[model samples]
Target: MLNWDDISREYQSEIENFQMLNTPDERNVRAFLQNCALELHERQTAVTRLYFDQEDKLVGFFSLHNDLVKVSPSLILEHRWNLITEGLTHFPAIKLHYLGVDARYRKQGVGKYLMEEVRSIAKEISNYSGCNFITVEALHSSLTFYRDRGFKLKDSTAEFHNMLFSLETLDNPTLEATPLISKQKIQEIRDKVMSVIEQSNLTYAQVAATSGLDEIVIEQMEFGTDVDVETLASVCQSLGIRFL
Candidate 1:
């Protein structure tokens, strides 16, 4: 049976050899593995998980990170799930940042297997964290691939589709009872994040440099502007903090 493992030094060689033909996916996989995966993993920016065959060859990989999803009022009304209240505008989620299968394993179920693993991880996180969705920004060509697996488009643009899979669908009673975050709660969390940054003895410029974010955005975040979950995650990673 194929086994899933966290990306580590032991698999570096195999990771270096793994390739996917899809240009964007290929570039991202190679870049992350070659330049950032290890540092990102150590900083808690994102965690890359690998799928290895019986011979221990790395055949595929996916990265997971915390994110926030903004549910449009129309989508909220249409779905009407417990995770989103009429008053709720945004919620935390787990993002599948990148997923790629070796070209040789394309239609042999490796992609599905990785997705199943992602769902399992998301389900486990929901038990302790306030995460409610498993999200992905999929390439245009893979729209049907994700839709067929129960992912619904939360939104879309010319370049990608933002999709979501609600954990509530897993029927975990605890998820049903989880309370929606209030505005006050959001402020409190933001305050805590600022505190972490201050405690780290790092300036906004330093954080921007380390996280690859614009310094002005970090300044705005410090002054209470709303930033996307991905941005917040990058900032947290730079500060050695956990956004979720």
Candidate 2:
């Protein structure tokens, strides 16, 4: 049986490799990598990370929401499930975020296996949350992937497809998440990153001259301005940190 240890290593490698986020004619892979890494890192700050592996490699991941907002008039913005209500808690929205696969294993059966497991988990949690919907933001390339699995587009902007599925048929979904064991790892990374930003420590400005703005942007991550996910993901790899 492939276990969580194998999955962790494989997943980390893939997130590092996620730096290859584009093709020849597609978007800027380097730029997108940073933003993706940052989003995954921040999302983990308030959400749980699920893990899964194949024989010797970790290939998939999912996030779970542990908090909820009440269901009421103000909370119900049209079909939206607002989780910021003052004091309502009948059913809460369990938002699914940042689903990705290892680049080498993308076309393999691993992604679907992990996804089905997560959906089943959501179903099991339904009794605990009044049957909340399971939702995800799908990349254009992955839209068919979700649709084939019975998910439909809930909403869409020009760039992403927001999709959903009912959690009524959750099976024995074998997955669980634990918090990362090291905040020191984060701090250690912060030091190297700070070095890059401080400039006096960098030997070569070329190496210091990266295409992404991770050093500065990280300082202001909480600001409303949009930071590039692709760029931050690359910075994470360089800084030796795993976004999971």
TM-score, predicted candidate 1 vs. hidden true structure: 0.65
lDDT of each: 0.74, 0.48
lDDT of 1: 0.74
CA displacement after TM-score superposition, residue 26 of candidate 2 (Å)? 9.7
Candidate 1 lowest-lDDT run of ten:
172-181
- lDDT (Cα, 0-100) at 74 in candidate 1: 76
Q: Estimate each model's TM-score.
A: 0.65, 0.47
Q: Which segments of candidate 1 are over 4 A away from where they belong?
A: 172-244
lDDT string, candidate 1, 1-244, tens digits: 5788777887778877877653564576567776777778778899988888888778888899999988886775676667546578889999998887887676466877888789999999988889988899877445545665667788777567899987887774322222345556556766777898788787887877687555666776787765444455566677777565
lDDT at 147, model 2: 58
Give the per-residue lDDT of model 2 (tens digit) for 1-244. Answer: 2233212333545445442334431233333332453454455643434344544454545555543423444424543433445565455446666565555454355566777666766777776656566766666545545655656566677557777664532442222432343545444545555565455444223322342222234443233232233333445565554644
Q: Choose the strongest candidate by lDDT.
A: 1
- C-alpha lDDT of residue 78 in model 2: 42
